[model samples]
Target: MGHQYGKKGEELVFWNSQKQAVVSNWIDVEDHKFEPPALELISELLTKPRNGLAPDLAVVAKAEAQLAKVLDVYEARLAEFKYLAADNYTIADVLHLPNLQALMETPAKKLIESRARVSAWCSEILARPAWAKVVEMKLKAHA
Candidate 1:
């Protein structure tokens, strides 16, 4: 599930932008308004150290704090809509799966599970067959 784009007279544009480009094309939604939150999640939560070395406690704390604030907004939005960016599942929601799964392995999992709406959303997204397949492939690779 990647995208390939190009101008008629030029070469194919592959990996030209970020996840936003791939998601926008795949879902065909005007997701401009959703970019900031996605970026925030990536920067705030996903950027944390995970190099097999124990991370600095302060760094983990800071990231969790930021995650709490972000999840607060999501909790409110989720009260009205089904997913993060919109009521329907979008790349914005898909964008969080990998990192959110990683975060769940840490103490920060409580931040997500404690929120009813956010927890429900996470459960639904993470349970998708696509994600399950990804998980299976990863386990096989590691094995």
Candidate 2:
């Protein structure tokens, strides 16, 4: 990636060293935004209605069971949790951790524990520097 200046004091990504042909021009800066909302919302939603139905279980058991199967894809991925493309940490860990903890700490214990790889992966990622950064941030706030 390259950038060319147009007599102005702004940096732009230049494409093939030509004018207005930027492959990737970006303003680098700090972000004042919260966590990316969509991923955060899924993690939050996964926490509710363990059977994956609406808050009202008034629906039939078969309906609830069908909804619960939505987790199978994730559970299958847990079989490859050891290969999440990060050595021992990743943004995936951040996205999944909260909801995972909620599951493990609830009646869903056996369901979660049935997969050993998931447990190990979660523990390993939680022990990494990336996750530790969040822990430190929380500690500082409480202190």
Candidate 3:
């Protein structure tokens, strides 16, 4: 794949040049400000447990605390708007889908479910066809 790009067909180099085109369409770094914290929550709660072991209880507890804080903010906004970034679905909502889906497998999901607004937001976004397709693709990949 690297060779397909040219002499120095490094995947990183190729990705660096093309990623902006794709990412710009999905997220506007200036406007959709929720991505960073959302990403942090995912990293702390989801990715950190991928070391072939269950998540550390202390770590999960701390992440859940952080998640509650994050949800508090979203919960307030969700009362007025339909999505995290705005009234319409945006990258801010999309960013949470996969990690939230993964979280559904864990006991920590109660952090989301306990918040009415946040739970509604999750239900709406997770029900999208695009997200469903992503889940399908992931299942097929594992299969």
Question: By TM-score, who's the top model here?
Answer: 3
How much is 69 displaced in model 1, in angstroms? 0.5
Looking at model 2, report the run of 10 residues with the lowest lDDT sum.
25-34
lDDT of 2 by residue, 1-143 (tens): 21233224323222333322211111110011112322233343444555574432333233324323433433565565452322333233445555444444443334345556655665665666755787788779999
Ranking by TM-score: 3, 1, 2
**Model 2 residue pairs with clashes:** 2-14
- lDDT of each structure? 0.63, 0.41, 0.63
Q: What is the Cα-based lDDT of residue 88 in candidate 2?
A: 32
What lDDT does model 1 reach?
A: 0.63
- Alpha-carbon deviation at 126 in model 2, angstroms: 1.8
**Cα misplacement distance, residue 70 of candidate 3 (Å):** 0.7
lDDT of 3 by residue, 1-143 (tens): 22254334212112343543433433453224444544555665667766554546665566567667767877887898876545555444566677678766666678789999989888888998868999999999999
Error of model 2, residue 9, in angstroms: 30
Name the lDDT value of residue 6 in candidate 2: 25
